[model samples]
Target chain A: MELGQKIENGMEGRTGIRNEMQMSFDAISENEAFARLAVSAFVMPLNPTVEEISDIKTAVSEAVTNAIIHGYDEEYRQENDRETKKVQLHCRIEKDMLYIQVKDTGKGIEDIAKAMEPLFTTRPELERSGMGFAFMEAFMDRLEVVSEPGCGTVVLMEKRLRMAEEADEL
Target chain B: MENNYSENFKVIDNYLMVRMPEEVDHHKSGYISRTADDYIMKEGVGNVVFDFEDTRFMDSSGIGIIIGRYKKISYFGGKVFAINTDTRIKRTLMICGLHKVIEIME
Candidate 1:
């Protein structure tokens, strides 16, 4: 099965997919904004509310930032190894739900549970607020992080959009 | 006295007002914090006002910049203020507990 097919099959209750797009870019700080803009544009067809768009943008920003800052170490980049230092973003819309996955092939987290703590940080000297995961969790309806030491980390986020008729009830 | 450091930074009265750029992520936050800190120390300004009228997005890095500034100014009986924040940015600030330390002005 194709990647899209795999994602669709893995997710239950997906009535129908409206669109799907996948992109890969170098793990650089400048690409953070680019990732956000790309995701925003891809999801535009859904006519998401301003608040919903903001939530998606913020979540993407956090995930990309993590891939750039914590994932790829400076020493690794200094070695001029570019191929393995890539960030992949996959987004798809099924029915009223938007699914996004950000994956990095850099240093992975050892303890997922500890890292998810609101104020936990590995690089405190860098002045990191340590709220990256917290913000991602707050902005999206569902979040999942999978990582293995010395391998990579993947962040999956999903948001359910309320149809116009459904929104009116609220 | 008035000193304009750049197009985005200016000192008015006793408040050092900074007009943030469109996006304030980790890449830009460090530079902003350093420049603002220099101004506060050299100019001895007691109040720092952030003008976010044009900012569209800010992440945890932006929060760190604001909190770092709050710590700097508060050390010398100074205060940090934010003006013209939109709903999204305001919510980010509130969630990070910045409203408790920095004053958000209308």
Candidate 2:
């Protein structure tokens, strides 16, 4: 699965990382589907159920879409003609828990609190539901957003996998 | 997008039936929205029925696609229906509180 020509990849571990992978790709809408699909494949070793796989994929989709749509200001990018925008996805698997980090170096969020509000979209003309963060929170066990104006945004999400036998509990 | 996705739109009994793609996301939302809205405007489609049988993965962008169409048609008393929704899709609808606006059918 390819998403926006992977620019860089690396592996780093701090807390006894079982497996970790990181890749950076162009921040274009074309990557949203492939990005999530790649993460879904990365977590397959956990033996996630259909529901769990869906959950992880949806969360990744939301994060990557946010990075492309909101992080890189469409108007500014269009004016500058510098479409080399990039999004970084880093995933680590330790035990049954999956940790995901999606980062972008585009214009950061001005008000993180208001941006996370359900149904509050900055680009209403585009028909955005403003449910990106909300959906990420619902699907993942933990979600954290850190951003600064003009610097960029980073979304951190973690999900604990349940084997097939335990999938029914969810 | 290159394969004339508008073919997926069909008007039956005044209801616009949309055969969603395999993966609905931001990349495809523009096409879905443009094609569906055209039917709603030109063919005068009343209600909208979104068939998710082909959709293996969908994010919140799918919600936007549904709601954008709902907003355009609901003013004329048109309703939106989601059919063939699975467990994950149902959970997403429930999470976003979309049941209040759109009807989910088995």
lDDT of 1 by residue, B1-106 (tens): 1133266888888899989878889878777888888889898888999999889999888888887888778988898998999988899988888888889875
Model 1 chain B is weakest, by summed lDDT over 10 consecutive residues, at B1-10
In candidate 2 chain B, where is summed lDDT lowest over 10 consecutive residues?
A: B1-10
The true-versus-predicted C-alpha distance at residue A167 of model 2, in Å, is 9.8
Which 10 consecutive positions of candidate 2 chain A have the poorest summed lDDT? A7-16
Candidate 2: residue pairs that collide: none
Report the C-alpha displacement of residue A74, candidate 2, in angstroms: 1.6
Candidate No. with top TM-score: 2
- For all candidates in order, the CA lDDT equals 0.85, 0.86
User: Model 2: what is its DockQ?
Assistant: 0.87
Across B1-106, the per-residue lDDT of candidate 2 in tens digits comes to 4466767888998999999899988889988998889889999988999999988888999999998999999999999999999877777878888899999986
Which pairs of residues clash in candidate 1, taking residues 3 or more apart in a chain or in different chains? none
- Model 2 residue runs over 4 Å out of place are A1-17, A79-84, A164-170
